[model samples]
Target chain A: MSDLNNMTAAESAATKAAVMNQVPGPEIEGQSPLHHADLASLAKQGPKTSGVHLRELKLLGHLTLRCNPANADQLAAVERVLGVALPLQPLTSSENGNYSIRWMSPDEWLILVPGLETFDIETKFRDEMPGHYSLVNSSGGSTVLELSGENVVELLKKATPIDLHAKSFPVGKVVSTLLAKSTATIRRTGDQRFELVIRRSFSDYIWLWIQDASLEFGLVVEA
Target chain B: MLHIYCPHCGEYREEEEFHCAGQAHIARPLEPEACSDQEWGEYLFFRKNPRGLHHELWVHAAGCRKFFNMTRDTQSYEIKEVYKIGEQPSVVAE
Candidate 1:
């Protein structure tokens, strides 16, 4: 096996892996995980204001980047591509406009970008990144949801066991925890707004769960 | 459910998010082919079921998904300390 620690730039460049553009052309329209849920119609027909508000962020790029944190060169390459340093702090997240990076673990980060920019970002990582690393595009595997309003906390408390107080989960904090019975990578985007990155398979279950939980508080679906 | 601290996430999460992966620090034989049947069976099947303080491997399945070593008192069900992988537990069984 080649020594990853001492690999020269030329050696790293030669070890390029095949990367495919998963995003299709404009002719082939993409669909969000909850497309079947018909949220757009509900946004218009549903109550204008309620205790809890739910919106599907929909069709964003989800990339999982795994690299060595100890390797300064690898870290620099990531900064060059993303234009922001990786949030090495545990449970922290950093964002640059449409691009948001969440610290998933010590050596792993989940990068979210606009749907159309997914392929471009992946290509940038391939050309810029060096040494032993893995960047996987999983946009098709999951979807995003934005929940807010006065009773958002009350609705979330019934589903997840995580402490949602401002003291523990302040803004810009990200935690991958159980959302109801399924897993969700939740980020506190605002004081009241939270972004949940949930699996595509569990989207139906969670949608129903959220609807049921928000019943007492009142549910407002937005497009 | 137990309140377990995930060393990677640096926070306490409910026990449902974690899974106890049996004993910790089980070293595989350097030369498995050289070992006899009795030695191989002992290495594979035998485990230490200590009554007091125990070192256990646990994975934060629903959170950061990282494995860490947890020192716990099996009788009292108290987690003494949670440390990252590759680090020796300070509270070893006496």
Candidate 2:
């Protein structure tokens, strides 16, 4: 942990919150949460057609923003950077192009963007937004899994207690809940599609859980 | 398993998402320095163990990570209401 507390007054004042480029250079390949699972090989060798399709949206930039939703300036700053307003409604999401924002709580929102665009967005938020707020780059801490197909909901139902019925858990709704034995921030992308943002440490456990749950309905690995 | 309503998430989640945090509305003595040893001991150890209509604290661990109060019936295992922290509960034991 780098301490800003030891810095000189001028240096401290000049410094913005620490933002690093987590994405590795071309020479070094970035590993997805399930990289060790070697899904790429499975995609080529495993069954091509199955009731469930699993894909990892690997190495995306994940930023956790904590600020006052009621503040007009902060909201406008977010809109200016992402070209989409913060989703004020509970359990809702706002998306523009490759950038998507999930309402994590009343005052917290998780923003996902292109891996390379993280620092730029963080800098923009620091320069544009005013008052007390925190923007944390958690890109390395988590990864996303895209689950789709006919039996996707059924597979999720086996692990989580939340109702997967379309009437109850509609599209664009996000919920932070327990998936199997691990925690995940789940969002409904479409009628039969769901996006799971899960911790990197628990990724392997979730992968095993999903594979076990999807065995009844054949699993198709998508790179 | 009990299904708890998280006021922060505005949804009813499984008991796995929550953890019971003992009794609610137990205010600490403001002037701890002025209190005697017996008074401090009473403040630390004394808690009501009622049979019905108890106000207890709970945390939505997996969902919102917010602490809230739940008015529950100990005998029936029924939740009367869920409210956020710092808010008063509507249901009371008479």
Candidate 3:
């Protein structure tokens, strides 16, 4: 029954922002937006081989960090917290094992960590980060979808207007752009693979979009 | 559709990804209390609708979400140049 200010540190009473653990107890269940889609059943029954493969990497920690890129202290503090330097270059991403950082804008980034580590990371940022910065735990707001296979590029091209050519968009490049009418933060993970960070509310729409668009190339559902 | 360059992203994205915020470089009056009604009215509602070169504020809404200044030809719909927010446009009306 922890309310809003339950997690504020006593040492820095006046200036600290309250951080809350959004995850519930073991008795409760935390279901992703696509939990009702029954992806597990689709994985088992869907085609084994297809031109495009879709998998929902659901329930991950989605943190939006807003800080000054010119601040050296903030950068070091972030590196200390995430163990990876914030990707300053526009339309780029950096990965440290399970943790991934996407450059959303000049002063903003979207970080994805493991599902259970959102609160831990948020608290760590609060303690270590300096100056004026904001770290919001937006895990429930969005979900990740990993798209791969031979025709993954084709499928994505149909949705987004960004140039998909390898010369223009290499591996690790991230672009927060419009995807099929909805918005998605698209990151290139591999030559044939891309990870799309989509809003939870638009998850069903994107899922339906993928299903409809990939029909020409064939789609395989992976759990 | 127009292909607009986002100075922040350092790339040219489709015009669909951006939104024209309106006229740029509209400095707010420093001393509003010591101003005439006509001056205040002009500052609040007046805007230039030039036929040729126009300086407009545009936002990369779907991309990096950064706002920049764009110098474009109003009649031809040709974007002359794009620059960052704090920087002034190199190509201006003659």
Candidate 4:
């Protein structure tokens, strides 16, 4: 647990919002949501070639921002922090270097940054951003899985009801919808590649579901 | 499965993405103290079970998580129109 009581009065006032380093030092190994499954070992022993390739982009900073898109100051503040403006268009994502912002709703956006930069970004937002808004760090609550390969779209179609056609769901599009029995924020990174942001608790179920669904197509675990 | 349009998301998502929240436009009595037992009972328990065109409240649970109104045909299961929560239904029961 983090030391909330040990924080000084000035530090407490400055960081009214909670911010903590989720990743430990080099001595302590950090585990992803699917750590128990040992996908890295499976990647070493599993088939070299498969129709579906799965890789977990573990420990990224997941921040949920809720503010009026129409607010010019809020937009300017975000651009200053991320070096990129928020993607105001619905279902779109804007990326600059390691920071990517996906429009979750008219008033909400999900921003992803390097894990180590989480606290710094939060502090900057609190210090600079203006108006009634919310910035929530949800990195511990979810993890991102990058899926790509020949049959990747086929596997996703079996799980979700959304149309996976490239014409309809172009690259860079994001959607919060059902993936198998659980929910995932699915984003198309390429014609056959997708990035799924799923809950930590449901990660195991989704992994199992993907394995079962990919049996016919064959699954390749990537480190 | 029924495909419902989410006005907020401005796209048609699957029915699984949404949860039906029963009848829409049911306003609570402004003066509860002035109402009798029958009025209170009607307000709390009674709801219309219309078979034709019906107005419904639904939440886009998996999508935007915003609540909206859907004017649907209960018989044919056809969604006539979908609007935001505060907006009026363009399609109504005739």
Give each model a TM-score: 0.96, 0.92, 0.94, 0.92
RMSD to truth, every model: 1.4, 4.0, 4.2, 5.0
Q: Write the per-residue lDDT of candidate 3 for residues A76-194, one digit (tens) a residue.
A: 98899999999999999998999999999999999999878888888888887766677899998999999999999999999999899999989999999999989999999999999
Candidate 1's C-alpha runs over 4 A off are A8-13
lDDT per residue as tens, model 4, A103-151:
7888899999988788889888877676567789999999999999999
DockQ in order: 0.91, 0.79, 0.87, 0.74
Candidate 2: where is the Cα deviation over 4 Å? Answer: A1-15, A24-27
lDDT of 1 by residue, B6-91 (tens): 87888889999999998999998999999999989988999989887989999999998889999998889999989988999898
Best candidate, TM-score-wise?
1
Worst 10-residue lDDT window for candidate 2 chain A reads A4-13
Which DockQ value does candidate 4 get? 0.74
Model 2, span B24-89: residue lDDT tens? 999999999999999999899988889999999999888878889999999999999999889898
Residue lDDT tens for model 2, A1-223: 4453333324433566666666656578788889899999998899988889999999899999998888786788789989999999888898999999999988999999988788788877767776567789999999999999999999999988888899889999999988997899999999999999999999999999889999999999999
A7-120 per-residue lDDT for model 1 (tens digits): 755676577667777878668888887889999999989898889999998989899999889889888888888888889999999988888999999989999998888888
> What are the lDDT scores of the predictions, listed in order?
0.90, 0.88, 0.90, 0.89
Q: What would the TM-score be for candidate 4 when compared with the true structure?
A: 0.92
Clashing pairs in 4: none
Q: DockQ rank, highest first?
A: 1, 3, 2, 4
